[model samples]
Target: MTGAAPATIVFGAVYATVVGLCVGSFLNVVAWRLPRGESIVRPRSRCPHCSASIAARDNVPLLSFVILRGRCRTCGESIAWRYPAVEAGSGVLWLASWLVFGPTFDGLLAAVFCSLMLVLAIIDASHLLLPDPLTWGGIGVGLAGSFAVSWTTPRDALFGAAVGAGGLLLLIGLWYLLRRVRGMGLGDVKMLAAVGAFLGVGGTLLTLFLASLIGALAGLLLMVRGRLGWSSRLPFGVFLAMGAVVSLFFGPRLIAAYASLL
Candidate 1:
């Protein structure tokens, strides 16, 4: 059915919550293992302190955290608060997307996009790096999705990928020429391409602008408080993810506002 019936809606709500939380759990593994060049599947969830393999029953996403009192069963070591935080955050974001778009294709796309944002943000925050697998892979997925759902014409999607990749590369070159330093890393460049693949040229630009503004503000604040030096590195991927989220949810309105202001 194009629209969910009442019973279907109830089922969907429950399923979305459960699935979102479970995905969040997987995402946590991905975030932690990817940077280390380790397979997420190789080692099952274990206690960080004691290396005790977790029982399946104790891996039930948010419930497990509550039940275990956020401690490792074998060692009684406290679990990082981030585990539940990411789980709940992803679940809520997925639920919000479902509420906004229903069970339609748009909802599914938005959900995947949001999940990607979580992965991107986590990796970036941890290592100041964005993996090509996630970035370029996201671009491919977004482009394929655009065609599956007819969100963009094949021509637009192709052009978007080209413009997205090219535009950022050009900016990086210019920045290097001006400063003799790397202003944008290759990871960020790949990320912009991925953003373009999903958002098209206009949406990609909006994402860049929004990310820059947020990153600049945050950096300035840190500098003002003497918490960061002029040369201190900032997490660019986090800003990029935020920009993508803002563009995904409010690009059209923001574009209209910009036009009006101009």
Candidate 2:
């Protein structure tokens, strides 16, 4: 609005970035611990190498990593680069959401989507496993968020969930019928369901298209490098996260562009 002050906007942007970085730190803990059935809330963050409880000063996200020279203060063990990278990436994503979507419920939802996508991508890439709690919990939160945001209504969210999960479920069933083996993990179906809950049917479809294309190209590249075989399994959820995040921010434009080409 013309009445909005530049200073206010700047403050909001800074606040969002700070919050994102903090949340990113928590997300890292979740990615590392949730898969192992550890309580994320309990026991403070510790060094994976030395099991020394990290001090609050050393837990300050990106700054701490740099301050500590990327080594554990207790054991001199090297810290993973992903820690600071996630924090930086998350801050950027939050800033992008604020700039692009503005300070509104839509922006908040966008930020949340980015957060979920980040952790999901990290977990899937590292473990090749997508935990049910996250997928299921994400779906519930996304559906709830729809009532607050203008874009996706309750009916649309439900339809989207069906379309996203149903499409994958069908493929899973067909693969089982034909090959007598599970072709994909149920985690994927649930993940898409969560995506659909936030994005709606069209966005869900767009995400699928983008993830498939990207995954295929990646697979081909790996095959060429002799790192992947025909029977090799790719962590598909990571690509899905990439696609969903792209769709969340740019789906309408991409969809229109594709339609024009057809």
Best candidate according to lDDT: 2
Q: Name the top TM-score candidate.
A: 2
Candidate 1: segments with Cα more than 4 A from true spot: 1-10
Candidate 2 residue lDDT tens string, 1-262: 2467999888989999999999899999999999999999999998999899999999997999999999999999899999999999899889888887888999999999999989999999999898998899889998999898877898898899989999889977997888776757989999999999999999999998899899989999999999997767799999999999999889989989999999
Global lDDT for candidate 1? Answer: 0.84
Tell me the RMSD of model 1 versus the true structure.
2.1
In candidate 1 the C-alpha lDDT for residue 137 amounts to: 95
Clashing pairs in 2: none
Q: Which window of 10 residues has the lowest lDDT sum in candidate 1?
A: 148-157
How many backbone clashes does every candidate have? 0, 0
What are the lDDT figures for the candidates, one per model?
A: 0.84, 0.91
Q: CA lDDT of 238 in candidate 1?
A: 92
